[model samples]
Target: MKESEFIKKNSVFWRKLKKELKRSGPLTCRDTFPDDYEKVCYQIGLSRQRGYNLELIDSLDSLALRMRQELYRKPSLSLHNLLYQFLVETPRVIRGNFSYVLAALFLFTLPAIATYFILLKQPHLAFVLIDPANIEHIEDMYRDNAPHLGAPADVDSRVMMFGYYIKNNIGIDFSCFAGGILVGIGSIFFLVFNGFFLGTIFGHLENQGLGYNLSLFVVSHAPMELMALVFSGAAGMKMGFSFLIPGPYTRLHSLRKSSLIGVKFLILAAIMTFVAAAIEAYWSSLPHLDMQSRVIFSLSNVLLIGAYVGLLGWKRGPI
Candidate 1:
């Protein structure tokens, strides 16, 4: 094969090597280029001597002898570098754990618990806990009874109900996830208390025949709200688990490593919570659905939550 034709076929490889040679003097041909060296030289058809002569012809005489030595260059993968350095590295820290999951459940149950005892034994406390003035603007709408337009009368009520559900439910979800930092117990307490409250509230609503209304309001936003909160709690629980099971690392190291698993979820949950709020605010309030429809919608929301958790509910790899 002609020198020029050989050069054309291996132009890219040769150009790169030539540039490296210019920056760092050429290698000697006698010292076998690491095992891979011959591949580069043979491909170019410029035997080490021919290359050395060519370098000399190009006015780089001093590099000729050095160029005779075959050189082996390390190859790199930019795709791998980019992915490993950023995306893959991030998820390593943000994982899920049993503790976080439990905590989230506990926190979500708080409302149910409060709704229980207070609904019967201490009815006043239920009123207080569910509509605590301590919570910002907890009684704002009830107190104001502000008029709403552009929707049916029931629509506004449904919307308000959905909003209330999201606000109340999302708060507990956040608590469950956040509480995981307390080594799972925090999350546990959060879940138990919240779940209890929710159960009790529904119980009370059921007795009053308003359960259907509540169910309808809940369906539209609950999917997003519940998932977001669960994710947050899962993150915290993962952190707690890290600390508890340090494995090869020190307690602090393990905790730091594990804590990273839930970060993306935490961020996503916060944003979803807000979207849920908007849905409650604008769409869910228009009470267009009847009782059966409401029940179906609520079930759909529950199903959606189940599916999402199933998809991203566990840790599959080492942190």
Candidate 2:
């Protein structure tokens, strides 16, 4: 097309793009800026190739420069924004996808409940679900008036257990998140298996008359750890669902779309697991605290977590 014709055809788009770049605040969708910048570059090239007047060419060059600056500008990082993303945006994402969260909860808890009751009826089932040596070790750890509930009596052992908890918890979280690639079968399997394992352990402790001790050990961090795992499973399920039902887009496109949300879930789950690990290491392992104190502290932590997630981003305007 002739220079004049080309200019007339795209002048409106160029003007709008420039307006967006010059706006006083950050663009709502920074993702579009690259495309706008590329279009401006193309327009500038065309203007120069078509032998447009010096004035028109210079104007296009100036516009292209502004586009480049805006496109390459580094975003300012602020503590407030970081906190808002962690405390608000993360929970908002979870709330928005509550259906998936509910599904994950059901999948994780149902097997636990069933296994708990089944083991209660048949104590020997614990031998089948968990290794006999491990069961014996766990039973000894929580035996009546055991010096330590779950961790060893020395500081080194406590530190080692802390590291182990972090590694184990995060490993489980990653496994649940990565399992989505298998059309969600892996996620389902891990969730169910974990639930059954936990239930078996719980039932075994109860059968051995160590339920109270086990409860005291786990109560503080169980809420965070269990919920984090559920979130991870939920993320995997979301990715798998995208493949199973691509909706209006191709399967690849749908998976890409779902990944944006799945990643947020994974991040939130990681944060929760870290918190749980810290609590388990420092507070839950303290042998000095009485059972009542531990129970109260655990309940308080659960309540605060619930409030933070339920109310932080409720009905707030768009991010």
Candidate 3:
């Protein structure tokens, strides 16, 4: 069939799909979505195969991409919905916005690595990024005879520590995310500052021969906790980038759209931080876990979290 005939035949279907795609309300089951999606996919391939006009091909391509974004973006609240969100939507969003996440990771880790090495060479300079008074406290916490970073305490004390962890880390996460309003400067500063701050502590402890205790204290929760930073930082950058490249939308509209996505990343960060707090309070604080055990536990965390974000929900469906 000719291109015009092909379009004329499917005009009603394309129009209906376009209307559904532009709906502002929650997407419900029309039971025709799968067929609509598959047909659109076929039309796209057919258009390209037949060397149709660029406009026809572009419209179909854009529609397909938006459909992919919305495929698992349901707003229902149920046990099944929650499971689906975690197993599918979360990873999909991560993969979709993964470049920002990588940028966040790079901005965070590069400074950390640089600071750790610099401080290791010149241990006295730790006071630049770390507080002078706090250095002694850290030494006391990780001293040879009394390593106390995550020292065992009563159940009540552990609960308090858990609360403290949540409060502090989430505060940082929020700052990293909210800083997007400042065109991402705030997020970058916080990530870089925190990196240097933590690196200073690590290098200073290592210099003082207290690295062993610190390793055991942080290993188990570090992966998830650090990923919270990545998520929030990336979210903020996403929001900030809206102003720089609003694309076809108005500035406010683009910001609103990007902020919605940013909030999803923040939610992921919050959940991970909660779990990190639990680990830090209960498991990481447990005394006498061997170095080998700590290493293994941390490795497992890395593998699990990495695989979940990198592997699951990987394929972009036609929807």
Maximum-TM-score candidate: 2
Candidate 3 residue runs with Cα over 4 Å from true position: 1-76, 147-151, 315-319
Arrange candidates by lDDT, highest first: which order?
A: 3, 2, 1
List model 3 lDDT by residue over 1-319, tens digit each. Answer: 8989988998887787788889976543667676677778888998999999899999899888877667667565888777767777778888899899999999999988898899888988988777788898878877756634445578988899999999999999999999887888889888888888888889989988888888878999999999999899999999999877899999899999989889878988999999999999988878877878878998998998889888887666422
lDDT at position 298, candidate 3? 88
Candidate 1 has an lDDT of: 0.57
Q: In candidate 1, which residue ranges exceed 4 Å CA deviation?
A: 1-103, 110-176, 196-200, 203-209, 309-319
Question: Which regions of candidate 2 are displaced past 4 Å?
Answer: 1-78, 145-147, 150-152
**Backbone clashes in model 3, listed as residue pairs:** 67-319
Count of steric clashes across candidates, in order: 45, 0, 1
Per-candidate TM-score against the hidden true structure: 0.50, 0.75, 0.73
Cand. 3 TM to true fold? 0.73
lDDT of 1 by residue, 1-319 (tens): 5656654665575565566566644343435443324555344344454553364234332333345543333434577654543344433333325455555655665556556656766545445655554322422221223222223556556566656766776676666667777776776565565566566565555554455555655667666766666667667777777788888999998877766566555655666787777766665555455557555665776775555445442444422
